[model samples]
Target: MNWNSPIPLQAQTLNSLPSIMESHEPLLSLKQYSPEIEVYPAYYREGLSGAIDDCLLRHGVAQRLKKAAELLPAGIRLVLLDGYRPIAVQQALYDRQRNHLLEQGWTESEEMYAELHRFVARPTVDPAKPPRHFTGGAVDLTLTGPNGWLNMGTPFDDFSERAATRYYEQKSDLQPDEQLIRDHRRLLYHVMNQVGFTNYSDEWWHFDFGNQAWAILTGNERACYGGVVPQASN
Candidate 1:
């Protein structure tokens, strides 16, 4: 099966979708389930403002991650880079991405924001249109094998064109390194997707469940989850 298709809906269109906000799931720690999967909180390690040391996800989302891990090939592990981001962290990420684009010579304009928002969502307080990470329904993750993190063409949070989930898939003549990256991406995408997660086309490491993105991609009229309240990290 080809896992290289572009996401039908764009990032900017996610907020416009209707969500009923039915889920009241509690956030759960990934640590309690550690060794089954690894938690490496990226923002926290980077010391971003309001970052949390503990990795977290909604109850159902965590369950799905566990299931996904169980299905991975032996010696391969799913590393959770981030989950359940606070509003402050989201804002920090947004600002950082914006500044980076500006440094790259992108003028401050609607086009610049459109590009920035493709990978980093603008922070929001509204429950109905929460950023994906803020909902505990989106997760940023990658795969690690016996040696270490599998090469996925680009590093996490790389906003370049190469970061697109299907970038490698669209390539015709594959070099050995490119082939390796494509296979690794395919493995991660299929495993998480098998457990009902939807990959954000712009980021190979990002996936969604129960949020507006997932609902829209899966053709559900209502999302089961909305913005989860940001809690004090343990």
Candidate 2:
């Protein structure tokens, strides 16, 4: 259930769509999800959420985020970094990076695109679909305590092996700071799991709810949210 991409989609095995999310549910501002949880939009200075120009996600997603925030220890809060990426935004990012890679001598082939796809989804519209962020179901977030942001080892969107949710677990290092990072990752993981989310095991900051990844990890027979469809948060 952990990879650069979602799980259910990762497996060639597919599921039928659930009627509930055949279309996107209303998009809800992260602020409306809970004032206790902080919203830090990474891409939008003038996107959705008008005044703050933050991001939006399905209303069902907001409900789960509220539940997850409630489980945090006193003084610790959830800080969402990115959400509801416009497909145009996604394409711009993908094109920039892919062009950089190509400049470095990477070839244009399925092999190359697959490697690129691991981190950035191709911006084209196809029956296969786009990245989770485009669907408003995926989010990049971290924990912030009274002191400051907990050390997650790397910043959000690191796109490296060090960013792996279980990266520290795979090492034999006895460094105290290393252990601290591992513990922080687990705290976020456990709380999100409690609220029915599935982590992108490869990226500690990425988590999905009501998407194909959620269905595969939670064993739901069908996925709800498919693409960039989100209704207002009720």
Candidate 3:
């Protein structure tokens, strides 16, 4: 059976898991640090027309990104798919995922939690608890070069555990007809890891800095990009 399909049943519940689980610590928090480095020019390119960019985080993040760019080979440049997602957008993403599962025939009782858990790191019944993008600390990105978008071994926002597996291994799951797709998947993971950022075990493109999960991973206390505030007119 296609597991993604909805089937009516009680929701899978987590009983013993701690309310607060530890992961890696964060690299920095905007609350404490005034971004010491220069922001990047390309980030202001109006790609994120609808989302938030509070504290000018797009600029601050650009600094770190510049460093990452230097570490890459001469041809590669980072292509940011998303950044500073608002809480509304986050809710939309969650709702879209849940609704798709329900349409497939999954019951709210059994499928709701499992569907969420599959994609989100810490799936909670409460709609209020969203991923770090809600806090503006998270971003979804990939790499590109003169050849065009580099193959990241998976599509953006692929909500499958297999996406997190090593690229070479992930290739085995593809149909016999799609070998090139598999190679791209592996290449993407390798390049992303070469930089300091870490991928969500479930999402090949999702990465964060200031959220609780990111803090735990990077050993930070506060999160960056609390929310978006409009820039003053000069």
Candidate 4:
């Protein structure tokens, strides 16, 4: 997939696939994805590790997370949901999503494109194109306190129009308590921005540190974590 094309999400579908029937196979499969829930060897704290796990963020991100944790009152800690996903894992997620749409009778070119755009950015095309996880600069996290997980306005990996900024603005019939959720969401964004991390906008739980996107936006020449994988000495 030529992901660099400037075509809009809707256009990508019209130009690429001729018919939905021809591209019936799911974009990726579940068996192909693996979650690397590795504990950072450096931050070896016992209970703290339970709340936090290493993700795609830079090597220095653990320290930054530790600093962020300090801002929280007692009993609240950052729960690292996922980090440092391999390119293969990303491909799997994309494929799984595509496959889901196909199963739902959205086997049309336009439908598939629209379905995908809801969760992923259109320009990026395939999950492995820019390989955000390979850069080790993006992390998926949430807040966890003594009461368990704090409501951050939305659920993790929620693929819905309701997950938007305006969603929090409108009072929902299902979720009647909007004020509390909105306040917590604002706090999460505030602390993350304080530490120089940028949210992905679409996902409240998603944050990026050192990457081309971060450097380009911040006007930094060098990013904190590149594509290099550190090797252990014998």
Candidate 5:
């Protein structure tokens, strides 16, 4: 089967979109939501600063995630990696990625920032333009089967071109492994999209709902969810 790519969201697009009315949806804990959801907090596991051990998302986003999990093929479980990141965690991730890029020979200039922004959003405190994870409406996830995590071409947080959602689909004469990767990516993308989540084109495991990115990609006039910090009760 053939798959089309989603348009990547730009800072300009997110900045221009206004939230007609802000949503005050409480963040819900994914760990308490379902057994099928494997809430593995990636940043926390890596010991990133301010990272929470449990995954959380906006109330509505959690509902959609449950629906998406139910829609996945039998024996496949959704692995929720990261969600509702604090500014500290976001800053840690951004700084780490920037340093990695620099070590990879990326110069400190507009060109490096353009590439860095593809995988990590610059840390921000502005409510109108919060980082994706800061809104509690974006999620990083992949699929795991009876055997284990399905190969989705690239691992979560992979900042290479192969990490693109449709990378394998765009290639020709794929090897068996590559073909499996493509199928897995397609399944993950379609299942989440079917439940109203918008997949981030730069990363197969990333998806958004009710946030600025989602609103921009889905043509919604206003974003419902904005930057929000998750409470302990969440």
Candidate 6:
């Protein structure tokens, strides 16, 4: 989505965006990286059939996941939901969400669309500038351990405050069962951060390694990923 929307970045990440945008890294697919890290390409492939090829990512993104997978506590596997989305797919998702918002009569306005994109990126047509997913450095995923799906409270695209990473962090007016959800979220937070990836505060299942968001977040001078076409650009 939008690189600097809801997720507040550290000072380092904030300073790296300009440089990160200048880099031209190549894209790499996760298909052959490691069998332990399972992938579900085009989980929301509703309107995008011939448009997408596979759930590819930057070589560095795959490498980070490889290391993150290895560091996962016993009886756990990193579950990749979707990766390497084309701008067409990004536009479709944004439009779909925006339409749903409008249908619900949520005050249609240009500002409303920006608000709508707080959860999803507005697809920028400029190939030189791509949304986080288009860069192939971002991924939507969740954790699965021996106990089964590590519930992070709300499901993967639940556009609500309950989806925030810090939502469960605070102990305000919480139910007894919610603590477990909070704990699981905390675990993922720690594990992912330890591996050098940044989480979009709005979406618990979403994480980026070296995209513009990641660069801005982690303070890297330049991002390691660029827009990824299904084949060449990364």
lDDT of each: 0.86, 0.74, 0.50, 0.52, 0.85, 0.73
Candidate 1 stretches greater than 4 Å from native = 1-15, 231-234
Per-candidate TM equals: 0.91, 0.82, 0.60, 0.63, 0.91, 0.83
Candidate 5's residue-wise lDDT over 113-174, tens digit each?
A: 99989889999988768889999999999989999988888778988899987788778899
Which tens-of-lDDT digit does each residue in 69-175 have in candidate 3?
Answer: 56555676666666555445555566767877788788878557776766743423242344555444566666677888776666666766556634444345666
Best by lDDT: 1
Tens digits of lDDT, candidate 2, 1-234: 231222222233336533224445877888766788899886564342322367587788888888989887899889988777776788776886788779879999988788677777777544245567777788889999989999999988776789878787777964999888878887888788778888887789988987766676667766777676334699
* lDDT score of residue 30 within candidate 3: 30
Candidate 4 residue-wise lDDT at 31: 16
Model 2 TM-score on a 0 to 1 scale:
0.82
On the 0 to 100 scale, the lDDT of residue 10 in model 5 is 32
The superposed Cα distance between candidate 2 and the true structure at residue 226, in angstroms, equals: 2.2
Single out the weakest 10-residue window by summed lDDT for candidate 3: 1-10
Writing each residue's lDDT as its tens digit, candidate 4 over 63-126 gives 4555666665567666666655554455556676787778878876986887786665333323
lDDT per residue (tens digit) for residues 197-232 in model 1: 998888999999998889988878999988877556
Cα lDDT of model 1 overall?
A: 0.86
- Show model 6 residue runs off by greater than 4 Å: 1-17, 21-25, 42-54, 230-234
For model 6, how many clashes?
5
For candidate 5, what is the TM-score? 0.91
Estimate the lDDT of model 5. Answer: 0.85
